[model samples]
Target chain A: MNTATIIAQEIPDIEKIRRDFPILDTKVNGRPLIYFDNAASTQKPWQVIKAIEHYYTNLNSNVHRGVHYLSQKATDAFEASRRKVASFINAEHDYEVIFTGGTTESINLVAHSFGKQFVKACDTIIISSLEHHSNIVPWQILCEEKNAQLKVIPINEKGELLMDAFKAMLDETVKLVSVNYVSNSLGTINPVREIIELAHSKNIPVMLDAAQAVQHMPVDVQELDVDFLVFSGHKLYGPTGIGVLYGKEKWLNQMPPYQGGGEMIKTVTFEKTTYNELPFKFEAGTPHIEGVICIGAAIDYINEIGLEKIDRYEHELLEYATEKLSEIEGIKFIGTADNKASVVSFNLENIHPYDVGVILDQFGIAVRTGHHCTQPLMDIFAIPGTVRASFAFYNTTVEIDIFVAGVKKAASMLG
Target chain B: MTINEIQDELIEEFELFGDWMEKYENVIQMGKELPVIDVQYKKEENLIKGCQAKVWLHADYKDGKVLFMADSDAIITKGLVSMVIRVLSNHAPEEIVAADLYFVDRVGLREHLSMTRSNGLLSMIKQMKMYAMAIQSKVKAN
Candidate 1:
């Protein structure tokens, strides 16, 4: 069968899905909102929003300590969310899942705590060129403090990791390998499973920065045998300020607690303090209670629709967008990895990405335009930035048509 | 003409546009018409800070008036640079410094003034005034 026939088969009810997000019904700049910045943050469905409201209204109490009724209920829901996260990623144990502020905090937790233990002077840490600043800066800080060296895995012209070079970089000096599962800037899906296996072969632990991965694909920690994995809640159709750090139980036991705070402590004394165990050791303070519960709700929402369907639907959308956008004259695609997610990063000839972004905004089409926190990648491409439009499952082909028209208009006006 | 009169004229000119596209078309036209900055003055030192687009601005004090020349890599930003230069250029330092640029809002381009916009038009306006002030101080010193 042809491409059109395959794409036409068994698509999700996008109109119904759009209704689940009330913001999709709203207008921006007197035109209907065309939200294409899903790679930044996905819109919260009503199920997730209602989960937040219900938590605050009915169960407004602290977890892990209070003996009262609401506290127990809140704690139950919060822990339930943790369990949901564990199963969502196929982690071996629920306790292995630690909650933090967001993916940045999660990565920092691993970088600081793991760095304090494993990384030392003359040691090396391997990260990729496609990393967001969150991943790069944390490792850099750790490397600086420990007098360790931070090595970068370079990418090809197609924005793919040079796997041979990565193999050469892995040696006894390397303590950890941290890389993004998906490139937020270019949408290049890294061969993380191969990366994990290679790191494991050399006895180095690998941490997959799944901040841009979890929402788009099914990630299994046990199956991938990943040492550590991190992802943000907001990007997964959940609330902000909540994220997950899935570490192997062995690593969690070895690494120190990220912060010294109330929940992170087992007992406190003037002389010395004992840190808590497993997940709470990293949690630190009173967590984002509602955000945690709503993550479970968001997972439920995704599970109900099914990731397979969302993945297929979004891939089709990406193909449609790519085909339509390619028709525009003087347009150059930035990242064209053989395998990509639902993101398109490109630029019009002689037009700054900022100008395209401004014009698209005037048309009420939301797109991200900048270095995308990957300035090193931008330097490699020898451009300032690209106009990136990332799609979620709720976006329709009609919206893509309008987006293409907007780009055509922008090209004509600016060309 | 007074800075206020120039601003009023700009506002009147922008009033003829039908929608955002037309307004932007006019802005792009103005940007295209803007005189190119001198290559020497377009160096790193003249580039405006806090602009998403690269904007190089240079000011010269000649005949007791501040003459401003500016350019930007982006057309929209260059247009905004042109508009700002129109209101403040070729005028006494004091007049340019004291002028209120109400035409931005009147032309429905207040969004460009927001720090979040990152267009650097706000920074450009501020830089223009600072140039005027610096020139004024230098004139007094002389």
Candidate 2:
């Protein structure tokens, strides 16, 4: 079956799903809020919110060391979250999942731990033109430190990754390949599975930054056979300051600990220190306890709704938004990739992105403006930034109508 | 302080200028109403760094009060400078130091400003308040 037909067959009731998020009901500037900034962070469902409250009220304690009842319950809940995260991404074992602060820290952990251990002088690390600064800077720092070369896979004018360029960059010297599963700025859903397979054939390990991908579709780490995958909980209807860094057991075992502190260590003496097993070895110090538990609830909520259904509903919204937004005079849409997630970045003729954002906010329509942490991509386009409107499954065509009207208003006012 | 008081003065001022286009046309006429800064004071020290338009601000303390003179290359930005000077011109140093410029939102002018322009306005206000505080500190030391 074709992908579009499979997607359309599993459509969800978007309005019903929208009711689960309380923040969407609130008004901004005396108008009904039309949130289009889902790329930055998604609104939390009641289930996720309640999970956080429940943790604080009923099962709040430090994990791993204490023998108390609360401590045991907390540890079980914390470790249970790891299992859920593993299953969510279809990883083989829960031990592969290490909880970090967010996608930024997760990428940094791989760069510091895996890059430091595996990378050597004169080796190459390949990333794409569409990478977030979080993904790019870590490897740049690693390359600078280890005297390695940082190679980039170029993108087409449509913001699609040039697969040929990616393949050309891979050679015997290319030790690691890291790329985003979806471009946050452009919303291009990359051919990550193929990219991983190609890299692996060259004997290079691949890390996928799934920050923008997890919310849109199912991510099977085993099926892709990526060495590492990272995603933030907040981008998937959970709290901020919590994320998962899933690495292959072999890689995780070989790599050094990201941070050295209390919880990550098995035992510490004046003479020597031994690290904990699997996941705990990487998650050091006091972790984000409440945020971790809330992620499990978010996983449950998404699972109940089903990602296939969510993807369909969101694609419908994207299609509608794309059509409506295109009707405006002088509106230039960016990232016309064939396989895109639910984001639309664009610029209006002669109007600055900041001006567009301000006018939209007046109508209670929220959109992101500026480089979107992909200044390299901006440099590629030769523009400073684009006004980005990203959608979630819960968002409606009515909201898009309001958004279109707001954009028209901005165009008339500023243009 | 009331909307009516401000509206009345604004409308009267608008009537004298006829229309937005005519008022926009009469540059020298508008400059006649604007309080001027000394040419000697137009140094790099007075320049606001991030503005797309060239802007200069100078202030003086007189009779325990602060007075400001400001100008901008852009006409609309000059109007914004005039609005700021109107609120802050004759205020005492301590009062100026205490005043929260976020209250500009109440008058609905801030709603029209872009976030970048609002941030620029904020930076300018912060600098002015810093100058006021510095003068206050010097007075206390004396």
Candidate that would win on lDDT: 1
Residue-level lDDT tens digits of model 1 in B65-133: 999999998899999889989988999999988888898999999998998788778888899899899
- In terms of lDDT, the poorest run of 10 residues in model 2 chain A is A3-12
- lDDT by residue for model 1 (A172-270), tens: 999999999999999999999899989999898999999988898899999999999999999999999988899999999999888888898988999
Model 2 alpha-carbon miss at residue A193, Å: 1.8
What lDDT tens digits, residue by residue, belong to model 2 across residues B112-137?
A: 34545532555677778899899989
In model 2, the runs with Cα more than 4 Å from the true position are A1-12, B1-106, B109-119, B124-142
Q: What is the C-alpha lDDT of each candidate?
A: 0.91, 0.83
Model 2: per-residue Cα lDDT over A5-52, one tens digit each: 543455535557778898999898678899899999999999998898
Sliding window of 10 residues with minimal summed lDDT for model 1 chain A: A3-12
TM-score of chain A of each: 0.98, 0.97
* Docking outcome class, model 1: medium
